[model samples]
Target chain A: MHAIQQQYWAVRDYLSPVLKESKFKEHGRITPEEFVAAGDFLTYKFPVWTWEKGDPSKARDYLPADKQYLVTRGVPCLRRATSLAYTDADEDAERLLSFGDGSAAGGEAEDWVETHAGRQSNADSAANPGSIDDIPDLDGDGAHEDEGLSSAVGNLSLSGAKVPDTPHLDDIPDMEEDLEDDDDAAAAPSKAAPSSNTVIDGSEIEVANGNLLQVRTYDVMITYDKYYQTPRTWLLGYDENRTPLIPAQIFQDVSADHAFKTVTIETFPHSGTLQAASVHPCKHASVMKKLIERMNAGVVEEQKAQRKSGSKDAKKKWMFRRASGNGKDDKPLPDDEDVEGMRVDFYLVVFLKFIASIVPTIEVDSTTAF
Target chain B: MPVVQFTQFSSLVQPTFWHELTRLKLEVLKLSDASVPLTAHYSAGRTIKDRNTGQEVALGCNFTVGSESFDEKHSLPPFAVVAKGIVKNYNTIDEFKNADKRALFSQAADEIWDSIEKDHDASALNRFLLITFADLKKYKYYYWFAFPALVAHPLWDIEDDWKEAKEQFTDKQLLSLHGHLEASTTPYFLVRPAVAGDGVDIAPVEDYTSFFANVPTDSQTIGFFDPSPHPSSPGWPLRNLLAYLRAVHPTTTSTLRVLCWRDTEPAHESGQWKSRFGVLTGGPAEGKPSAVGWEKNPQGKLGARAADLAPMMDPTRLADQAV
Candidate 1:
């Protein structure tokens, strides 16, 4: 709610191109205050809970120790790409000095302090070689955003931080239902109850496809949808010899959920897949919250059990063991709950990967329980 | 190992913008992670003397201000991603009909996949990306602030006048402070960046270093805090840099954006940060270095503040939990 009051730009230089696109039906410039006011993503229906694995080896470490009843191991989808390097600052002194030559007009010590820092500092410095940009008219009224946001807000309880169950969090809009009722959304599902994602191997009746008849395997990929501004999952399947899987092969897996849930998207929106079965993003916060909470509870329960059975000194020893690393409890711990990569049920992720795809003809399987 | 990370936070938080900030926190994190008790000074655009060339040059300027577009020249410096690969096994429900090793594996795998996807659908779709950004600008930004955190370390130690702490600095270091004092009305800290001896880069050492020059090989502990006059208006890039450095990555100790802006218009009023020796404590002079465990690499010291900021990392505990 930046409203009409704060220092806001009606013109969005950063988002103009994307917002002007037809994908987003509603368009307007967003202010920093309003952007921050949008609040946390946890409040969204299908909040994307990203699980970060630092190295590729990190993913291998996420395998469950006890695979007794394990099915397909969940595939961690690629989300972000990163790079970092630490340089010797002293060595960089030469490099830093050689950087773009900005004028540095020398000024009084009182006139050139640090808070005076900004993107314009260099430009302003370039204007006057040795003087500071303390002159009010030049940049004090310059086009920048609000005063410094003192609160970093990193503790806003979004990334699995302890967010108390508050009533306001429950007011999430029914994004899926609203879309289902809209006409001209070409991809909305026509089938009744039990969505494609839920009807897997269920009793739902199968629908007929024009000429496609074979079931196929495809990788489920989730990408953000510009139209709805939400995450949408798409199917990228393959056959033997690694040839791209046909629409039929991918659709075969969706017999029941297929008829009403998906739209055969011939053109891949942003990924490498040939054609995809697109659908609405699925709901995942609850299950993920359950998994996280259970992990914490398991640790506490194990500690409590140990305390009751062992001597106080042994208990003290156990605490030290966990802290210093390597103990019997540590032995039991790894086998119990080490799967920490971006986690999701392999099937559920595939199912919701395209919640917003296939146009608007089919709707998400809202009634089914995950 | 000290990598500042970022991913698309939310729709409100632009992806490309955040992607640019990914490597930012590393500078402060690594400095604090290093055993060099440090401080951050707002040194943007200040004329700094280059020892190598004997030429006085203006340091960094408010690269984050002037325009709304991403700092076209400086912000998104090219960075390489070192991602690890993962092998994915693909199969369908029909493959489970047979009893071969392949069929059995497919059946089991498909079952777990179905259960998790079906059960955890919502949360799975919501994403918090963890990606890395590596660049020299990140290193520069770190030094820009680290200089102050390094110098502020001395002031944090004593209750009496910090001039007592100033005595510890060498003439060269004091001269740098004089340079800072002469350059701006606001006070700033000055220090020499640490190099790993040889012409090449060195891995993390189990030791600490002094922030200044002409010090004894054994003295890796002091820097000069100059009371340079700071700027009045706040800018976008500097604020973003500070906030990014203080970002919270649960696995790592949290760093706070401790820099602040001061009003130079009302010149007569001296605030809490204003020291007696024409030095005022605002900007990078604010926050203390986060506490680090030193049970691994012991630095010879007495002050509680310095000891807590030691950068020793234990291989054992860190390795036990790879997340």
Candidate 2:
């Protein structure tokens, strides 16, 4: 066995006796199965809960051996169960049910263990119950809401039990669908359902009861817009010779004076036991190059139109006054003339640089998920 | 001694005629001495009698140098010795003798030499001789008749001496002379020559004669008749000199002293009888100088009191007081 697994069992073994003694003292009688169950729950919850004395539900004094056993074995088991529920998809459903059971146990065993041990351990039993309650509620929601809540709680619960579940090979397609739906919802809100939103690849095995079961597997599905899929051809050179591959439209308004044109390169995907060579080929570079050329032509055309309009507006301003002359002469004096100077708006340059830097990221498909 | 009696006449004589008569008296004094008392008699001719009354009126007068009494031995020498010296040098006898041959010379000599002697003396004579010769050389053709014939000649030199002596006489004589000719002439005297300084020539005699000729003969002489009795009436030339001195020596009291004048009659009471004359005393003994008072005649008419002469004397000072 691996060291992590051996360490897990050692804690479990040490806690079995304390859980048995605590259950017996608190309920006046307790079976080994109930003791094991309580011990596992406490191990999942570890360090967040401890046994105490004089709990209203318990009848006997808590003993030192029982207290030490609970701390050494039951707390670690409860912590392991919580961490496994977060990171291992196979354990998620079991942990959800166990969390409900743990919340129902209150501090009866903890009180019994502390009284028999003749020690005071006032670990927050109230705080542990709150986390226990949070686990079961997460499962009843839709996949999108559940994933969001899970990720959010995953970060909040830095303790072992609250880690997020890793994607399984069989479950990857569903997760991909959920992520795609979330991205779409975040983006256009009113767009049609995404088409390339699922992944399918996993093996099923028959168990001893002849029930069909799936082995643990992992798959990562990535989705991106046309920009990120074909980024190489979108690599544009700036005045400073810095090349950016992002779609300029992603970062800047196409109608603005400093707007840029863009293209998409290639999309990337990662999966368990899958080599990059097996991935399907796409005309990403050619598409990106064509899109970039088209966008560049459009930008040139817009610039010409802007120049023509600007020159015409300037002519109008020079020939006429904006305000009423109120019967005074509207024309400038014969000797009075304006000399035009060359000017370039630096704000436009800075804005273009910012767009270039960010657009390259949007154009390149460096990650598997959208 | 013979006593000569004569009747007085009613008609007033012209002041020039009186002046000429006095000049004749001085001439007689020059021809005589202290031991001989000089006397003169005048018979009013028909013209004079007709202007007055048809009666024949005769007048006699006598003049002596000093008294024969020892008690008054220190008195001034009689006019005779003084006048003899004057006449010896200034006499027009040669011209009078050859009157027809040199009529212009004789007439010129009489008007120039005689007038100078009657108004100047020895020191003034020397100054006059030197200055007149310079002025003649400077203004030869312009002052043709007067400068050479009267001022530059030897006779004119002596006559200038007597004229100087007359100016040194007491203020009584000076004032009397001023009044004596005030009506028929504007009385003028020769001031000390150096009073005008080295380079300046005496004022032209023609200017004085012309000024005298234009004096209003009908106007009354309204000032003191005795020079010693009061102040000398400053003639136009002396007044002009005093004005120049006042301008140049404004801070000096001695220069200003010559400008003082006194009126015999106070301004409020005198009316037309007022008399105005220059006071020979330096200034008022105490307090501020008071302006001389007299009757003013704008039209040059006798007895016309149209304005007061006090205002004319120093209008600026009166104005200051009024303010």
Instruction: Find the candidate with the highest lDDT and give its number.
Output: 1
lDDT of 1 by residue, B249-285 (tens): 1121132211222221112222322211211122232
Taking every candidate in turn, the Cα RMSD to the unseen true structure, in Å, is: 34.6, 68.7
Task: Give the 10-residue window scoring lowest on summed lDDT in candidate 2 chain A.
Answer: A72-81
Candidate 2 chain B least-lDDT 10 residues = B126-135
**Superposed model 2: Cα runs more than 4 Å off:** A1-370, B1-85, B89-323
Docking level for model 2: incorrect
Off by over 4 Å in 1: A1-217, A220-233, A255-259, A262-269, A272-274, A286-370, B1-323
In DockQ terms, which candidate is top?
1
State every prediction's TM-score relative to the real structure.
Answer: 0.18, 0.13
Tens digits of per-residue lDDT for model 1, A143-247? 342232212222211112221211121221111111111121111121213232211111111222121111112344443333333334555432211123233
The superposed Cα distance between candidate 2 and the true structure at residue A219, in angstroms, equals 99
Backbone clash count for every predicted candidate, in the order shown: 102, 52
Summarize candidate 2's per-residue lDDT along A224-320 as a digit string, tens digits.
1122221111121110001010121111211111121121111111111111101111433343344344434444443344344443222221112
